[model samples]
Target: MDFTFSTEELLIQQMAREFAEQYLRPATRRIEKENRVPDEILAGLAGLAGLDLFGMNIPEQYGGAGAGYLSYVLAMEQIARVHCGPGLILSAHNLGLGAIANFGTDEQKARFLPKAASGEHIASFAFTEPGTGSDPKQLTTTAVRRGDEFILNGAKRFISNAGYQGPLTVFAIEAESGVPTAFIIDKFCPGYSISQPWEKLGWHGGDVVDFNLKDVVVPLDNVLGKIGDGYPILQFGIAYGKIGMNSLALGSTLAALELAVRYANERTHREQPIAKFQAIQLKVAEIAGLYESSRWLCYRLGFLANDPKSYRDFAREAALAKAVVARNAQEAARISLDVHGSYGLMQDAEIARVYRDAAMGPQIEGVLHMQQIILAGDILRKR
Candidate 1:
């Protein structure tokens, strides 16, 4: 396997890196501290870079650039390297689009993909209910069929883009067939409302809120894929999404390490840069090693996602990548913070913001414990 970037991939990666440094880096700290991301900022990102809804893996026919998974992962890594909140929003858009690109019928694609790809309508996913996290089969949100439309009556918590006043891609169980299904619920839908803003420890740039669907009626044409196939559809999209999240964690690790190294070189102790000290050198080396390892694993998973035949086999690999990288990033952030000394903990410090964001890594995609157990179970069962 030739794990090398082609000229095109390199160019794309460079473009993403430039955008990250120029557009995202400067305001990332402010976004985190203020805990409010202006809608105009998000719109500007989408408009300027066309990243608002760039689903790199989706075909151009559906408004995507017809890029591959590797390109998508590389772009995500660059974006996350600058700021995780926007990175996550981008990741959610890709995941939501992937589901429709892979499974949605022509009508479904016609209705959403063009707008989703162009960032005309910011996208979101609603799977985790009030209590259902890992066990989605226990979902209580139900959709009862009433002639031409289905009445959706349930609430989803911790939904990204919850109050953004845009279309939302929702999942619920159909009452008649007891089958899980996906639907596009526009913000104008009467029963849809964002209840409250969720104050989070990290990822403040990404709007997180609780949504209530009180007898919201969605047309039958809005259903994604088959009536009862939402489970596998969501699972597949989430597996890919986890890869993107892992890339986010890896990118954050790289950023933290670079920041620490820079700080160490500039700060001197006893007429010598702290970077020259054995203790600082050791921490820097550790950070480099962890970042390199996690990054390669993330790339491998992205490449493996190209073919659907091996997707199931990649589930454990994806989960493991997310778990390992997230933990490594959390540690890297803390160590970087320590390297900065008292300044690191300052409310205005970027490292402090990164430290807070890093704390969220292990909990974002999937719980580390569950992922580790799943990896072990997959190994034992294969044996």
Candidate 2:
């Protein structure tokens, strides 16, 4: 397999790098402090012709850039390298949007994709509930069928982008069949309301909040895939979601490596640069190794996503990649912090922010142990 990026891929990567450096880097502090991305930044990100980032993975027929998953991964890494908040927003958006793109009817695609691709609305996926932690069997949400609509009632927790005006793919159990199903509902509909945004440790501007659906009526056509197909749909969404998560972790690892190397060169120890120190050199080398390893794993996962042999195989690979990359990012960040010594502990330090962001990598999307379980199960089954 060739390791080189195509010319178009390189261009997309360069565009994303420039955008992150020019726009996101300057606003990183503001985003972190305010806990919100500026409307101008969001508009620029979506409206820019060469950098239609929100639509990278969407097909061209849906008014997206149609850059494919590899292009999307390249762009996400650059974006997250400067600041992860925007990356988080894009990742969660795609998590929901990918589900619809892969499973929705043409009519549903026609209705939802254009606006979402244009960033007039941001998409969200809802699966987790107060009672369920990655367990679909424990879902308490209920969907009751009526003449032409299904009335939904449930509470979703830790949902990202729930406050955004767009399509939200929600999972609930159908009352008649007692089977879980996925539904597409417009955000802030008559019976939809969101709680205050949850204060998160990192990725500040990427909003996460609790939301309630009280008799939220969804049209019959909005049922994604088939009735009682929520499990497969959920698996597909989570698998694709892991690709975004891996990209973010890889970016964080790269950032941490860069920060450590820069600190080593700039900080003087005994009237000489700290790079002269073997301990500092070793730490830098370790961080670099982590970055490189995580980078390839993330890129490979993205490539696999473009044309997977099977969803089960793709899901297994995604789990493996995330388990390694997320933990590597966290380890790299910790090593970078050690390189910074006491200064890293200060709130004003850049490495401190990177540390916090890296800390989230292993926890979000799926916990580390859960990823282990997925991969382990796959291996055991093969045996």
lDDT string, candidate 2, 1-383, tens digits? 79999999999999889888987888999998999887767775443323787777889999888888999999999988988988888999999999999999999999999888877789999999998768889999999999999999999999999988999999999999998999999999999989999888887898999999988989999999998999999989988999999888888998999999999999997899999999999999999999989989999998999999998999999999999999999999999999999999999789999999988888777778999999999999999
Model 1 residue runs over 4 Å out of place are 38-41, 44-53
Alpha-carbon lDDT of model 2: 0.90
Error of 2 at 43 (Å): 1.2
1-383 per-residue lDDT for model 1 (tens digits): 79888787777788788877877767776777777654554665543236523556767887777778887778878878878887777777677777778777897887777776766666777887888766667888899999999999998888776665545778898999887788877865798888667888887777778888999999988887778878887777778778778878888898899999999999998988999888888888888888888889888888888764676787877877887888999999988888899989887777887788788878765678877887889888999
* TM-score quality measure for candidate 1: 0.94
Highest lDDT scorer: 2
Best by TM-score: 2
**Residue 105 in candidate 2 has what lDDT?**
94
lDDT of each: 0.78, 0.90
